[model samples]
Target: MTGDVDVRRIRNSSFLTWVGLVLGSWVGLLWGSLLFMPVGAGFGIAAASAMGGYIAVPLWGTFWGLTGLSGQRNKALRDLGIKVLPDDDPLTQRVGALAARLGLTTRPWVAIMPHNNAFAIGATRNSAMVVLGQPLINTLTDAELDAIIGHELGHIATNDMRRMGLARSFQNALVWYFGFSRTLQRWVRWILTWMSEFLILAMSRRREYWADAVGAALTSKEDMISALEKLHHKPRLSSYERHHARLMIHGVDSSVFSTHPNFLQRKRALEKEKYLRFVKKPVVAEEVLAAPVTLPLVAEMAYVNSK
Candidate 1:
């Protein structure tokens, strides 16, 4: 049931991948442009400058927001107490290897946080970072961790992380612009924001499913499922954890507005996948095999020899 677009076979080869930052930047810019968010807010932030707030704020926010997201990525992450691993770290090496196997030209930084959730953040693939919960990391197997990393990398690869960042920013801007009103204008703004959030949450849920599929394909169905199952819990949220709840990988939220799908739903979806499977003979294209070597030919040869 897996389509070619949905399930990409892991590739270990790429000629253009090794050429350093110039080529990598080109690739990232292309990917980033492809997934770029719009530059308009439902509740406009008037330009305090010459340009009206409606026009200028979005343009301004879109520009610096993306730039700041990339430039301050490390600082922002560290502020959350995420311990970004060094390049020489074993865990980093393992994740880097997985990124290579997935044919990712720009691998993200691997970080650990003292929370019960895993999530990815960045404006571009070049600046992407995947943060894992330390508790999960200390307890899970290497393969399982790879599965988790693969899913987060999927977000980085598709640039969904940026889309999420912008969507949330827009949501907050709306709150600021409309927060003071007490009349119909305020109520209307609230309705629009609520509707937008509902739709965004739906998209987020779908992205989670796709990321799970990508992880399963990049690692193994078993590892992804195991990782999800192991990390699934009712976490006593710290202020930081609760603040970034929407970005987290796993949660028990079953509401229509929940950013993530139910854990059991994710598990069931994974149960149907044949991704990143480990087998003596990995499924290869039929054309790659020697078509002339038929079973009947072997049987005929054996019969003649016996005679």
Candidate 2:
């Protein structure tokens, strides 16, 4: 047998984490949170802090997570110093028009990155920003570009960032603040963090597929398909951005922690969805055909609103 070991599968497995969660959640929460009781009694802290340990930290963490303007800070992008696309730029106009169509309360600031990838970031739709790659601009047609932007906007429209952030903060509070029962912080934290997988249960992979459906509906199925076909490679990203892979358009294919479906899987799923171009208007005294759309009506509404 070759001495080279393949740990690729093991790295992303959440099986052990799940086991620990099932067995340790109650013990960790009940014991850890109440430890503040004895700690307060011994240290003689203020009555509010003594009594507040259980609720305060969690609320604080969640508030910061949900309301934090993540896109405003470029540290996550490794200080790449993003320059916002010009308002008069064709691509910028397309992005703005698409944002309006999606009914996003916040007008996303579109920036061009040197990498061949794109992503959306913000705690909520109100703070969303869309970062596009320079290379991707030259690679796709106008329609394809709109479809790609539409996919990113779908993420903003659903407020995926805030949801994921809230989950992360909630779990962090439970792990760091409350997971200290009888000073056994190490064991408690391990269990809690393992259970949450760092970003709380990890954003559902379904969101990626849903975004694809929305993109297809907003533009045309052909454009969406073409865009996905062109972007088959694993995206190149800076270290910090790679750390935030869950927010990007592309990622590892078959890992449990991956935020996107495999390209083939996405394409196949899109084959069964309803795009605006595919939806036919009703006609009297004519043969009527039903469109087999597996996606929700929200996609249709989004498409219609854009028109």
Candidate 3:
């Protein structure tokens, strides 16, 4: 069953990679032709356009896609204020055990920072590192933390960071190609930017769902859902900010610019019995009604339970 899931995931990733390559190539070609036309007009528009599309665009896109603009290991760690965990640390132990369970031959560097979230970073499987925030560690239980770590491992296993980097490179190429313009070209570029954003965000949301499934596979459906609730309820905001954040949680604002799906939507998806059954887990909704004042009662309950 796990083997089948792995095969399906690999196939999906391959499909997305091909789609990104083709789309990126086309976008680059269009942008390259526009820029090259000014100089290439001496050779005639048709020839210049062909040269830009066939040679310049594909070469540029390929370089960016393969090399990647982000994923600099040192820079990422430094920016996040991440410090490596000692071999004996419990978190490090947990990470090692989890990596072994996931069949990762090259274990990811485990680090911690002073924030409320955890994420994975690396250009490839061999270089992957997982960073957990101090607040996240302090707030979540052992089981909850395991579920969250599973999600980050899922990102590494699925190569989401690399895929997103390639997509971002295409977006950056578009931005650079259009940055010089001021009038109609600038407006066109703005529209294209939004289009690229929508596509990237769509992919990001799907990746999150896939990661959630991986998390469930690693832990339990209940544990994954509880972790999500704990993450949602973790207190890091002021009263006023919390109120506004709640509105955003309900998706009052546009999600076009957001990367992850709304938490409520994610929880609902996890609640589905069909998905739980597929993962060979029994589905049992632990009902926690929302308070009149506070929107998500599960988060409140989770907070109380943790206390």
Candidate 4:
């Protein structure tokens, strides 16, 4: 509304691009590794070491990646002074309420982590977890918190979480090449890290845009814009090292090849389109509706439908 609202169609371009990057990198890594596989095998360390590297990279990456996100959620929750609902708590009842209102199948898990960020990830439509940073919770108000949660829900609704998880899995598998410590191995890791960092950054940027659109669609563009503006007030650093102190939860150290667009780029996008143009919620309300009321009903329906 601020300018022209020429929303582009979801071309799946970003998804495809992510896939290509993962696959290409995997193939290159494997092919290059095989070259040294012989040397490793000659010492009888090739089969075990190469295979371990192959398997270990993805496994380790997935484990730590998920662990890092969980850490972020814990940090954010603590900072926000919000209670994390116990598995059987009445708040679980509210899951359906929020999900139905947001038009999602499940309510994303809201947790805190130690960074200044938020993200959503899960394999199934019903299994989303939204992790937020402690800094974000401490810094933003309740309305701002809602807007941020809404944005993360947007990621779940768009299935970006699942897609991103897969991309990360693939990238992790390819990182097996890093297990060896040769000049070429180091060089390859460096190059691949550079390339993966670039691609991940790009994919993250597009997903950020898409998620912004989603939040705007569910809540209101103004809320999203307000949230972004709130973020703008926080620190902004140029280099990866400079930003690392704040990005602990997402563990999105650009140095570590994690998924995240540059911070400034994110801020600009929110500003460009007037972030709140698409959301439906008013900035202020009598009480923040934590979740929708019909949550149980929809959950039941979803359960029945699965049958």
Candidate 5:
């Protein structure tokens, strides 16, 4: 049974891995050629320039990956009022226990944002942080919360975070490579970037399915379904929340640009898992987890925004 589950997890991850690699390589080749061609022409060494262009792909990609872009993003989020919980805190402790149960040797840092969402962020598993929001805590029962946590952990366990980071870095490099040119090269870069995004979003949606499976394994399928239903409804946001939401990049239309699958689609996918068929329903109490220490600050910000 364990082996079969592992196989399924591996299959899902492998599919995304190949997609990212193919798209990244295609973008890198085009980006590298554009960047080096001019420099090569000026130096009267077309061959050297061509080699340099090819080499730049892997070189720039490795540099971006090692530079800790995700860590920097995490820092930016912290500056915007996200607070990291200490390991001894109740919520952090609970998440740590859950991580252990999921066979993780290192526990991810737990943080709270003032928004109404939960997400995982990090370049690697050891540095990963699982961020939750006040509204999510206020809205979900303990079992449902467990399911969400499990889903996030699944992202870490499957290395989806790192893979996505690498893919995005490739996309970023392409943007940088094309930033100054007014020629047809810029248009080409735009088209390539669009294509890359589609692949990246597809991988993201697949990862969500894998995470939902993990959530089902950790908690009951019913709990996962209930959590998805709750998440479907947008929680009332303070003006501060609204402002932040505006700054965040969201897909206005089309799943091709969205990082997550639709809620109903995710729920239905979880229902189809073979293991879930035999799993008994959970007897969850109608109690939500206590709000973290950051809740008051979030609430205060919301209150001030409303006023």
Candidate 6:
């Protein structure tokens, strides 16, 4: 019975395993080359007055592309009124210790946002930021939050955060390429532009599933599934909560174009594997473990995987 179940679970893992990594990398490379290459080449040609400057355009573009991610992250933080936590707080220590346990080379800035939320984004492994909502601390148990943190760490490990930055860069380059005008040229251009945002977001959603899988493997499948249920069962659009309009763990929108999968799908995906095994010998906080372990954060109390 154990062998049969393990084989079935392994098969499911295979199906979803590499798909997100391949898709994120491919889209990143494709969109980066298509959108930025021309701009880099143009700048290089225009700056041909200086031999070194001409040679530096492509390199410059790559540098700026990554640096530009900071601005986008800042805007998101600003809009949400997220406050950066002082580095010496107990919460920060706990979260950082978990991050270290997870083997994340970069330590993300920890912030408190107003909503029941947490998100990770940065240009490189070193630039990742993990933000948690105050409400999450009040709502979720320690382990639930850990599962959530593990999910975000998974994103950092996979460089999905960097990929998101690259996607945004592609969008910006697309806007520049089209002169930021809706002068509906041909059907082809319209189709391409119309699908650009969708493609970027779709790619993000795919990465979410990968993160979920990783989180389940790190913790127990039961932990991930239970966390989802907790999020989905929250009061309907509670205003006192941190995020209002955003359909996070439990909220809903009239439309189907959600940034994430519905709670049921996520729960099923994580719980359809071994549960008792991991829980029996769960990996906990430590500098090192003999076996691979995942570290999670408090925001995961309700939220996991941002796409």
Q: Tell me each candidate's TM-score.
A: 0.69, 0.67, 0.72, 0.54, 0.71, 0.61
**Clashing residue pairs for model 5:** none
Tens digits of lDDT, candidate 4, 212-290: 6655554455676677766655665335324432222222424334445444555566666543344434343434455
Cα lDDT tens digits for candidate 3, 1-307: 2221231333246346846666665654455445545553554563454453454444555468657524456776666467988878888888877766666667788888665667777777688788887777887888878888877877777777777777766666655555555752556567777777788778777677667776777777788888887776666544433332311211122475656676776787777833434433333344232324465766888899999
What is the Cα-based lDDT of residue 247 in candidate 4? 23
Q: After superposition, which runs of candidate 5 have C-alpha atoms over 4 Å from their true positions?
A: 1-8, 11-50, 73-77, 178-182, 236-254, 274-307
- Model 3: CA > 4 A from native: 1-19, 27-54, 65-71, 178-184, 236-254, 273-307
Q: Give per-residue CA lDDT, model 5, range 150-205, as digits (tens).
A: 77877777777677766767676655555545653557567767887887778677
* Per-residue lDDT of candidate 2, residues 101-139 (tens digit): 655545777888877777888655666678887877888
Top TM-score model: 3
TM-score of 5: 0.71
What C-alpha lDDT values do all the predictions have? 0.63, 0.62, 0.64, 0.54, 0.65, 0.55
Per-residue lDDT of candidate 1, residues 1-307 (tens digit): 1222232433211222212212322332232222322466222222221123244334443554456566556666657777889999988887777667655666678888877778888767777788888887888888887778888877766567666655555444444444444642355456646765786688688778777876777667788888888777544657776577667777535889787888888888788653323211244668456556789989999999999
lDDT of 4: 0.54
Error of 4 at 254 (Å): 10
Worst 10 residues of 5 by lDDT: 245-254
Model 1 scores worst on lDDT over the 10 consecutive residues at 12-21
**Model 2 TM-score relative to the real fold:** 0.67
Rank the models by lDDT, top first: 5, 3, 1, 2, 6, 4
| Per-candidate RMSD, Å | 10.1, 13.4, 12.0, 13.1, 15.1, 13.6
Residue-wise lDDT of candidate 6 within 273-302, one digit each (tens)?
333232122334562545544455545643
Once fitted onto the true fold, the runs of candidate 6 whose alpha carbons sit more than 4 angstroms away are 1-64, 73-79, 179-186, 235-256, 273-307
Deviation of model 5 at 139, angstroms: 2.2
Ranked by lDDT, the better of candidates 1 and 3 is 3
lDDT of 4 at 21: 48
